[model samples]
Target: MTSARDIVPISARLLERLEALGTPRDRVLAHAGLAATTALSTEQFFAFWRAVEEVSPRRDLGLVVGAEASERGYSVASAAALHAADLAGALHTLARYKRLTCPEVVELEVARGEAHVRFHWVLATSEVPRLLVDSTFASFTSLARRGTAGAVAPLRIELARAAGDAALLRERLGCPVAFGAPVDRITFAERALAARFVTADAEAFSRVVPGLEAELVGRSRTRSLRDEVRLVIARKMSSGARPSVDQVARGMHVSARTLQRRLGEERTSYQEQLDAVRRTSARRLLANTDLDPIDIAFLLGFEEPNSFVRAFRGWERTTPTRWRARVARG
Candidate 1:
C-alpha cells in the first residue's frame, strides 16, 4: 500500500475555530496525543478529530468550525484562492494546493447542470470519521455561501456511514442529507461556480502563485529516504520477492553501506524500516481486504503463512483472523 508523506498541515482554520470557542491549540493537541505542531500524518489527523470531540462542548463541533473558517478563509495556505476571479478559480486553486495539506483528493466537477464535489482519502487504511467528513463538506458549502450573493444551499448531500447526528448536518447545510451510500458527495447549483468571489484580488493572487509553486516543487523533489525505501520494498514484496538492503540501495543509486549510514542518520536501520513496513502493510491488508493470511503472506513475501502469523502476533498480539473479526464487529 502507498502511504502519504507528513502531508496534512496543521491548518490555521481548525485551530482558530477551536480558539474562538475558548479552547487553546495546545490543549487540543495535548488531548489528541499529538506532539507535532507542523503537520499531521493521516492517522494523526484522525486523532486530532478525537481531540476536538473530547474538548469541545458543542454537539455540532464540526459544523460550527468548518462554517466559521469559511467566513474568514484567507490564510498563507490559501493566498492564491483568496484572490481567484470566480468560485471555480478559487476551488481550482485550493485543489492545486491540497497536496500541501492532506492526502485526500478533492474533486470538483461541474456536470449536467450541477456542481459535484467528491473526496477520496485514497491511502486511508480504514473509514474516514463522520466529524472530519462533516467538517469538510460544511467548509465547501460555507465557502460558497460566503462568496456568493443571496441564499445558497446544496441540492443534495450523501454520506457513506450511519446517519447518527445527521439532523445537525441538515440544519447546518440546508439540504436533504442521505446516508449509507457507497461514496460521499455534495451537489451544488452549477451557476454557483461562475459566481464571482466577493474576495477576489487578481493582482495579489498572481503574486502568491510562484512562491507556492516553488514550495510544492521543493516538496516533490525532497521526499524522505525512508518513504522511498518503503515504496521500493512494497513493490518488490508485491512481486513476490523480498527486497534486501543491497537491492533497495542499488535501485536508489547508492551502495548498501551508504544507504545504511544514511538511514542511521535518520535514526533507523534498513531492517528496522523493513519491519515497520511489514507491520503496517500487514495490518492494512488485514483490516481492509478479505484476503486470507496465506494470500497476504504471499504478498508480504513471507516464506509461509505460519511465519506471517507469528510476526503479526508479535506486532498486534492477536491472530490475523481474530483481528479481522474484531474490526468487522466494530
Candidate 2:
C-alpha cells in the first residue's frame, strides 16, 4: 500500500473550503503533520475531515463544502481541464492529471448513451467514510457545472452507502440519487460528452499538456529499476497476493530472463527487492500504525506470523516487539 507520506496532497480547493468554514489552516496542517506550504497526505486530509465533523454542527456540511469547490481549486489538474476543448476532453484531462492532487482512482466509461464516471478510494478499507463519498461527488458535480456553465447535469448518481435525506440529496446534487449501489458513480447523457466547455482554451491546453506530460515522464525516469520492482511488489502485497518473478516480469512487459539480466546490471535480484520492500514496509507499519505484528505480516503477504518474526529477526537482529520498543524510545 502507498504510505500516507507518499500519497499526493488533497486538492487546494478542498483545503480552501475547509478553512473558509472556520477550520484553522494551521490546525489542520499541524494535525496532518504537514507544513503550511507543502501538499498534504490523504491520511492528513481524513484527519482534517474528522475535525471538521466534530466542530461543525452543519447537517449539510458536505453539500456546503462541495457546492463551493470547483475545478479552479484543483491546481494543475484544474488547469488541464479548463484548457480542454469540450466536456469529455476536460474529464479525460481530469482522469489523467488528478493523481497530481490525490491518489483516488477516476475512470471514465462511455456506453449505452451515457458516460459512467466512477470514483474509488485507493487506500479505503471495507467501511468507506460518508464524508469522503459525499465530498468527492459533490466536488465533481460542481466542477462539471462550472466548466459548462450549468449546461450539463448527471442523469443519475450511484452511491455505495445508504442514501441520506432524499430531498436534501437532490437539492445538493441536482440529480436523482440512488443508494446501495455497487460503485460510486455519476452517469451523464451522451450528448453532454460533446458539449463545448465554457472555459476551453485550445491554445493554452496545447501549450500546457505537453509540459505536464514531460514533467510526469521526467519524474518517472528518476525512479530506478529497483524502485519500480519495489513498487510492483508493494502493490501485489496490498492485494493479498505475493507476486512471483515471472508475474512481475510479465506485468512489466519483459521476459523473466531479461528482467533478471536488468536487475543483475544493478547488482540486485528479485528476492533482494522483495526483502528490502518488506523490511522497509514492516518498519514503517510498526512505527506509525497500531496494527499487530500478525496483521502487518498478513499485509506484507507473509502466510504466517512465525515466518514474519523469523525474517524480522534476520533483518533487524531483534523481535518485532523489541524493535518497536526501540523505535518508541527514539
Candidate 3:
C-alpha cells in the first residue's frame, strides 16, 4: 500500500555499494536524475535499476553486487538496528522503518520455530524486475551477516523470480536458494533472533532512534520546488545523462514555463540547481570516499574526467585531487 508520496529515495550509502563494485555510479544517478546526495523515489530507483539491467552482462548482477556490500550502505536505519539488544530487535526496527529505505513492504513473521523476513514490492507495474528482488535479498542477507557478526545464516532464501543460477546463491549464502516462490523471503531459525549483536548498545539506540524517527516525519511533510528539482536532477545525472528542462518539468507534473517561473520566484534555475547538487555531491564524495577523480567525474554526469576537472576548478579553484588532499589536511 505504498504511495508515490511515501516512496523513499535510494540512499548515497546504498549507491556507494554499487560504486564500489564498479557499476558506474554516475550513470545510475544521472539516469534517475539523482545526485549521490539525493535519495531516489521508488519509481526513480526502478528506472535506475532498469538502466543497470540493460547494461550489465551478468544475470546475477544484483546478487553479486549485494553480497559484497557492507552495512555502511544501510544508512541511519542500520545504525538504529545495530544498536538493538538482539537480532529480533534489529529485524523489527528495519521492518518498521523500511519505508525510509524504499517503498517496499518488509514483514517479519514468526511461525513454526522460524522467522520469515519477507520483502514485498507493492508496485503498480505490470511486472517486477528480477534484478531488483535479487539485489534486495542479497543486500538484506549481507546486512544481517554483518549485524550479527557472521553468526547468522539464512535457513532458506526464496524469490519470486524464476530459478537462475541457484547454486551461486546457495554457495554465497550458505543456504538453499529457491526461486518461483510466492514471495521474496528469507527464513532464519528462531534461535538466531536471540543472538546478540556484537555492536549492540541500547543507550545508542535511545539517542539515535528519535532523530531517525524525526527525519521520517519530516520527509513525509511537504517538499519545496528547489528540493524536488534538485532530487530529479541528481537522479538524471548519474551516468552522464544530462536532464532536460522539459523532462524535469514533466516529472514535477508542471509545464516547463511554469516550473521555470516558480524556480525564478525561488531565486534559482534548473541549471543552477543541477550545478549546486553536483558540486555539493562531488565535494562530499571527495571528502568521504577514496574513489578516484575520474569515477567522481562520471558520477557527476561528465562525459570525461577532464570535464569534471574543469567544472570542479570553476567551483573550487582547484583540481579534485588537490581539493581532496586539502580536505584530508584539514
Candidate 4:
C-alpha cells in the first residue's frame, strides 16, 4: 500500500469544503490521524476516505472549496483578479496559485500553443478517481466562466483510463472524452487565449501571487523530496545507468544519509526505487523497442548480459528472450 505521506498537501480547498460541511474540525482531524502517527498508510487513508465520502456533503469538495475561497477572497479566482490583464493572465494566475491548494499531483503549465494542465492524484481511500476528474473539469469550468469569453468549452479531455461515472463526465464536461490515452490533459484552444475577462485588478492580483506562492513553496518542500528521488532514478535509468543512493543523493544536493533517512520516512528505500524504475523501463523497452537482450542490458546499466537476464527473470519470472518472443508471437 502507498502511504498518506504519498499524498500530502491535499487540496486545501477540498479540506475547507469538507470542514464547512458541518463536520467538526476535530472529526476531520481524527479522520486524518495518520498525519500524526506516521504518513497514513495507503489502506488506512483509503478506508478513512471512504468513510468521509459516505458523509461528505459535496462529492466535488475541491470545487466547492474553490468556490468558497473565491467568495472569501483567498482563492485562485482572487489571484486572477489581481493581474489577469486577460485570459492568459488568469491561466498564469492559476498556475501560480494551484500548488497552495494541492501539492505534487496537479500541475499547470503554459506554452506558446496552449495551457497544459495535469492531475496525477493518488485517490484517498474514500475518494473516487472520477470525483477528481469531475472536480477538475468543474474547477476549470469555473475559471473559464470567469474568463474573457465567459466559460468557453474545453477543446478535448484525454483520460489516461476510463472512469466509473462516464455519464456524469459527459454531462458535466460536455466535451469529447478520449479514454485509454497515454496521458490525461485538457486542451484549450488558442482562441480561448485571446478572450477578455471582466475583472482586471492587477494590483490586487500582484499582491496575492507572492503570498500564495510562498505558502505553496512551503507546503511543497516536504513532498518534493520524494518526487525528486523518483525523478532522479527515472532519469538515471533512462540514460542507461543504475544509479546508487550516493549518486542520487549527490545529484539532489543531499548527503547519502539524509536521502536514506527521508526515504525511510516514506517507507521506501533507494534500491527499491531504483528497481521499480528499472522494471518499468524494462517493460516499456521490451514492448516498444527492437533492441536485443544484451543491448537492452547495457542500456539499463547492467554490466553483464547474464545479470540483465537474471534481473529480467526476477521481474517477469521469465527470460527476457522468451518475453520478447511471447510478445512477438502475440
Candidate 5:
C-alpha cells in the first residue's frame, strides 16, 4: 500500500472528471494511503504518481485531464492557431490557457536572445512536481505538434532544489535540467518563433480564448505575492544583506511604487513577506542547526541580538533559546 506521504493535492474538477472515468476517489486515496483531509507533500505526491503508474501503466492521467477539459467546452488547441505574429504570442496563449487543465503557472519570458518558460506551483493541492513538469512538457510538445512542428527546440529546465526525478525530466524534456535554481525555467531556441501553426483553428479558439484569458489574468493577480517576495528576498539574502522593498523593486526593474501596488494586489507587503521568511528560516535553523542565537540572528540579518529576541518572541511566542532547547529535547 502507498504511504500517506505519497498523495498530492488534485483539483476537484480533475478529480470529478477522473470519477467520471470510473476512478473512484477512495481507490485513488487508497492507492496513496492518504486521508481525504490530508494535503500531500511534494515527495509524497510524486510517489503517488509513481504508484498510479504501477496500477495503470498505459494511461496518462494528465492527458486524460486535458481531454476532459476539452470535452467541457474548453479549448486545448495549440497557440499556433492564432496565426501568432511570433513565438512570444504563442507563448502568451499557452500561459493564458495552461491552467484550464493544470493549476500551475507556466511563465514565459524573452531575455538575451532566448525564450524562457518556467513552471511555478503552490502545490496547495497536488504534490507531484514531476507530474506537473512532465505534463507541462507534454502540453508544450502537443502544442508544437499541432500548431507548428519543430517550433519548440531543445529547452532547459530550472527546478527547485527539492525537486526529484532528474532522469525522467531529462528524458521527457529532451533538454537539460538544473536543480537548486531560484526559479524553474525552460529555455528554448529563439529561431523556433519562425515556425507557423500547421492547422490553425482561430474561429474555434476565438469562442473560448477570451474567457480563458480573463480567468488566467484573475488567477495571476490572485496568486501569492508572498512567495515571489520570499524568492526575491531569499536570493538577495543569500548573496549579501536582505533587501528592502526599494532595493528589491530596483532588482525587479520596477519602481518601488509599482512593486508596492503589485504586492497590494495580492494582499501582501514586502515587510510582511520578509518577516515570514525570517520566521520560517529561524524555525528551520533552530531545529536543524546548532548555531547560537547571536549567530542565527546575524545570519537572518538581525543587526542586534535584542532585535532577534523580540522577533523570535513574536514568531514563536517564546525565546529562541527556549525554542531551540525544546526542539532539541523533542
Candidate 6:
C-alpha cells in the first residue's frame, strides 16, 4: 500500500498492544493485506487501526492504549515534554518534536482566555479513524494529568469527524464534546498553560534538547553519505571498537572505492565524518552524563584514555576536564 520511500512510523505501540491481547501480528498484517516490514506507511497505519477494531472486543481501545502509555517509560519525544517547565513548555516541545519525527502536527494557540490544542495530519486524505482521535486526545489528557498533578482539565473537545456518541466521549474525557468541527481540537483555560509540571527537570530537558535538535535537522531530508557512515561508526563504537573504511563501506552495501569516490564528490571523507561525530558526541556526553572520561572514551571507540584525551585536546585546545569545568562555570 506504500512505496519504499514512504517510511511512516506510527502506532507500533498499538500493534504491540494488539499482539499482547491475543491478536496475532501475522493475522493483523494478513487482514490489512500488508507485507511484513520494519515500519508502517500512513495507509498501513490506518489499516492497522481498522484491524484492531475488527479483532479487539473493546469498543474504546484507543483511550485504553493511549491513557496507559505515559505511565510506562516516556518516549524520547514525550520525555522532552515531561521535562518541560510547565504545561505550555511541554505542549510546545511536544509539537516541535512531533513535527520532526512524523507528518502529524500538533499546535497550541492561546487567545480569548482559552488555550486551544489542535491536530492536523499531512497525509490524511480520508477521515482519521475514530479510534486514533480518541487515543490521541486521551493521551493528551493523561499526559497533562501526569505532568500537572491533575490540576487542569479540558474545557471542550471538537472533532472533525462526523457526529459520534458525544455523550460517551464527554463522559470519558470529562469535557464537553462536539463533532463536525473544523479541526480536531481541545480547549483549556488559558491560565492552565502556566501550571508547573511536578516532573519537570531542567537538566534533563537541556540534555534531550540537543539530540532533538539533531533529529530535527536530520529528519528534514534523506540520510546523506555522512549520516549513513555516522550510523555505522556509532554502531561500531557501541560495540567498543573503531570502524574501518572497509567495514563502513560494507555496512552501507557499497565497495570501499565507490564509497571513497562518493565521499570525494560530497567534499568529505569517512575519517573527517568520524572525527566530527566524536567531537560533538564527546561534548554532549561530558555535558549531560556522569560517565567518566575513560568510559566516554570507550563509548566513542577510542582504544585508551590517552587517545581520547589527545583527541579532545586537539579539538578544544584544552583538556576535556577543564573544558567541562569551564562549561559548568558558565
Model 4 per-residue lDDT tens digits across residues 30-53: 664544322444345444455455
- Alpha carbon lDDT of residue 315, candidate 4? 82
Give lDDT for model 2.
0.72
* Candidate 1 stretches greater than 4 Å from native: 1-4, 20-27, 72-79, 222-330
Q: 1-330 in candidate 1: lDDT tens per residue?
A: 124465566666667767888667788789988786565677778777777777877778778766766556523444466577777887788777766666555667677899887765534545666677888788777776765544466899987665577778899988999875545789888987788877787788778888889888877775678776776675566445778888889888999999999999999899877777687767666665556688888777777799888988988899999998998798
Candidate 6 positional error at 132, Å: 0.9
Residue pairs in clash, model 5: 5-44, 6-44, 9-125, 9-126, 147-197
Structural similarity to truth (TM-score) of each candidate: 0.64, 0.62, 0.59, 0.55, 0.54, 0.63
> Tens digits of per-residue lDDT for model 3 on 58-111?
777888766654455454565577777888888888776665666555667788
- Candidate ranking (lDDT, best to worst): 6, 1, 2, 3, 5, 4
In model 3, state the lDDT of residue 61: 81
Q: Which of the two candidates, 2 or 3, achieves a greater lDDT against the reference?
A: 2
RMSD of each: 7.8, 8.4, 16.8, 8.4, 8.7, 20.6
- C-alpha lDDT of residue 76 in model 2: 75
Candidate 1 minimal-lDDT segment of 10 residues:
70-79
Residues 1-330 of candidate 5: C-alpha lDDT, one tens digit per residue: 322322335556656655676566667677866666245554455555555544443345554554234234233534323444445667777666655434344565566777766654433222233444555565565555445554555567665434456776666556787765434456776767666665455675677678777765765664455555665665565445757888778877889899889888878877787787777667756665556788778777777889999998997899999997997788
Query: In model 5, which runs have C-alpha deviations exceeding 4 angstroms?
Result: 1-25, 30-86, 99-103, 122-128, 161-168, 178-182, 213-243, 247-269, 275-330
Name the top TM-score candidate: 1
lDDT of candidate 2 over 62-141, digit per residue (tens): 77776665544555775678677788888888877765556555777778888888764443322334666677678778
Evaluated at residue 97, the lDDT of candidate 6 is 85
Order of all candidates by TM-score, from best down to worst? 1, 6, 2, 3, 4, 5
Candidate 2 wrongly placed segments (more than 4 Å): 1-5, 10-16, 26-39, 125-128, 221-330
Evaluate residue 37 in candidate 5 and report its C-alpha lDDT on the 0 to 100 scale.
Answer: 23
TM-score of 1: 0.64
Q: Which predicted model would earn the best lDDT?
A: 6
